[model samples]
Target chain A: MKFLSNLINGISLGSVYAIIALGYTMVYGIARMLNFAHGDVIMVGAYICFFAIYSFNLNPVIGILMAVVVCTVLGVVIEKLAYKPLRQATSLAVLITAIGVSYFLQNMAQLLWSANPKVFPTIINGSIKLFGGELSISRTTIVIVLVCALIVVGLSIFVNHTKMGKAMRACSEDKEAAQLMGINVNKTISMTFAIGSALAAIAGVLMCCAYPNLQPTTGSMPGIKAFTAAVFGGIGSIPGAFIGGILLGVLEILGSAYISTELKDAIVFLALIIVLLVKPTGILGKKIHEKV
Target chain B: MAAMLEVNDINVYYGSIHAIKGVSFEVNEGEIISLIGANGAGKTTTLHTISGLLKSTTGSMSFMGTDLMKTPADKIVSLGLAHVPEGRRIFQGMDVEENLDMGAFTQPKSSIKGNKEIVFEHFPRLKERRHQIAGTLSGGEQQMLAMGRAMMSNPKLLMLDEPSMGLAPILVDEIFEIIKALNKAGTTILLVEQNAQMALSIASRGYVLETGRVVLEDEAKNLLNNDSIRKAYLGG
Candidate 1:
């Protein structure tokens, strides 16, 4: 029964990681860039949600929506301001810029929201009982799962069917050729960041609901975990990121149960290292052949 | 016949390397213009400059009366110029259908279906492997896919940068045949090739570029008979 409860908890938590991982995967796929500031964007989203719920006394759903919109706008602005100029620059320069942006956002968050953790008002305070061993599923878990599933389905359809999605895939595969095809690479890259950040924001709100705590640095662990998931499942593959997140979540929970809670993070890192060592291209990632 | 595309004294550079220096050429409407040269003779650079991939530092380039120098690479396609870049830059991760769809990025939503059918008709192999990931395709198949993808844009001018690069001899002949057919279909072509023999044979007009300068420009047969061109590039 305890194991079942842990399993459920792990799944719910893993769903949150998956939500954040989507942002990482989408942005990485499109730009071939690792936006290190993505984690800070998640933190920003949580704080935005926190303010909306606490200060304005808005409904949780409305707050989440507003947070997503705000985060998306911020994402676009960041791309224009920090990334656009560096588009033609070297990979190292772009990477350094990303790290700088991450640090700046973290510090800005600290300045605005303060360093200490603030308790978020839980919309789903109570727990529900399930069959057999009476699994305790919170409203927060349900919301997280529903949101994650909806985003995944929505993203899948968007990438596979829509014109914009096709453009994005083209840009991801070959930016220069995509441009020659008349797909605006800049606009597509901006859209990628916007979607990625918006998803991160939603994950933030969901994380707040589940844990009911907000901090300036709240996005760090989740961000690293999500990044790990992205790499584990193949950084550029969306579906791969989803599966990686869920697997990571399950592993963490199982580790905590059988092993020590202190070693859970270490175990996840160990798994990441082992997987990368075994399959450098990842399980779902395709091997790329560069023409000589 | 009025020139459809004109390059007037254009100068292009790659860092410190002065690639295309004062290079000039003109392609009349419905003509196949081949720019043949050695490896570092700015053949690819000229094609790239005209396609808006690399902006020339000096001189002017125009396509169908529109100024191409000021235009962005993405907008160049909408202006009816399709560039099949060097090394067949196909979307490796995308399937054939998706890659073809990308070519129609600037086209109206209504015309995509029609254009796609036309592309598939030209390259039946692409249609057969429509769902297969592009990276998995063989070298010749990838080249075919690249050409098919460019065709989906329905361009007035098709700029091919070494389409025959890394292909079997039989495949090369087949590719040249397709290029000829496409030219006959009224698409103005700017072909950059290291295979001077095949290029001069198919091209109505030819330009020989030597170290970023236009050393020779004449009718295809004239260049085939040129002493310097035959000795150096055409292999006698």
Candidate 2:
């Protein structure tokens, strides 16, 4: 029963990681650059939620909406201003630019909101009784898991069934060929950034409900962990990110419960090292050898 | 007749190295024009330049009365221009059907059903492997898939670069046959090939490019019968 409770908690935590990981994976798959700013995008999202809810006195749903809108626009602007010009530059140049953007976003958030942590209101209040309230689950955990699942399903359908989605896949496969096929590669890339950032918004709001705390750096730890999840699942593979996030979440929770509370983060990183050393491509990732 | 595609005094350079120097040519409507040259002789570069893949420094390229110089590469496809690039750059990760879907990306949903049927008729092998991953197909099948994909757009002008590269002799013959058939069906063709003999056989007219310059241009039979062309390109 305790094991089941830990499993559910792990799943909920992992769902948050998976939400963040999707942003990293989709952008990386299409643009072929690790978007280091993705983690900070989550911070921006959380700040937006705080502004809309606490300052403006809007409803929780409305706050989430604003967060999504702001993060999506922010993502598109960043892509156009920073990443677009560097498309033809070397990977190292692009990597450094991404790191620069990440740092820039972090600093901007820190400057805007200051370094102190703020208390976040619970969006989804109350816990449900399971096994006569002995192993009850929090509303936040259920909401996170269900929301992540919905987004994941929606993403797969969008990618595999829609025209724009097919264009995205084609762009990832061969950008040059996609261009010849009349796909507006720029539009496709922008859309990818938009969707990834939109998901980050929801993940950010859900994160506030779970942790009930908002800080400029709160997103950094989860963002990095989710990136590790993406790599663990196979960087560009969608299901891989989902599965990797869940596994990482469960293991971290279970490890903390059974082993050492303080060593939970260390255990997660250790697992990442082990998985990478063994599989290299993550669990579901396909080997992407550079085409000659 | 007015030219459907015109390239005037085009000079393309690759980072200080002049690749296509003052190259000029024209393709009239409903004509098969072949540009035959050896490797690195600027044949592919010319095709890339014309299709907006590579921008020329000082030249004017107009297609269907549209100034190609200002248009981006992705936008060029919707202007009834398609390039079946060298190396058959098919989306290897996608299935055959998905590849065809991408080819018809710019078209309205209502047209794809018909266009796909036409492509399947042109290359039944692609239809046979419609659900199979494109990379798993044989080299010959991949070539056919590439051509089929190009055809999906129903372009007024179709450009092919080395369609016969690394294919079996029989497959090469089959590819040329398809090229001729497509030309007969009213699509203007600009073919770049090292297989000069095969390219010249079906083309209405031909240009022999030597080091980024058009040294020879004549009707198909005249160029085919020329002793200089025969010695240099046909390997007589």
DockQ of each: 0.77, 0.66
- State the lDDT of candidate 1 residue by residue for B187-234, as single tens digits: 989999999999999999999999999988999999999898899997
Q: Please provide, for model 2 over B1-236, each residue's C-alpha lDDT reduced to its tens digit, 9 standing for 90 to 100.
A: 56999999999999999999999999999999999988889999999998788999998999999999999999898899999999999999889999999999888889999999998888988888899988888888888888889888989999999999989999999889898889889899999999999999999999989899998899988999999899988999
Which candidate ranks first by lDDT, i.e. highest? 2
After TM-score superposition, the amount by which residue B98's alpha carbon in candidate 2 deviates from its true location, in angstroms, is: 1.2
How far in Å is the alpha carbon of B140 misplaced in model 2? Answer: 1.1
Model 1 residue runs over 4 Å out of place are A290-292
- TM-score against native, each model: 0.97, 0.97
Model 1, total clashes:
0
- lDDT, candidate 1, residue A196? 97
Best by DockQ: 1
lDDT of each: 0.89, 0.91
Error of 2 at A260 (Å): 2.1
Q: Over the stretch A1-292, how does candidate 1's per-residue lDDT look in tens digits?
A: 8898888778888999999999999999998888989998999998988889899999978988999999999999998999889888998999899999999999998888789899988877767887853777887787788888889999999998998998888888878788888888899999999999999999998888888778878888899999999999999898998888888998998998999999999999999999999998776777788652
Error of 1 at B129 (Å): 2.7
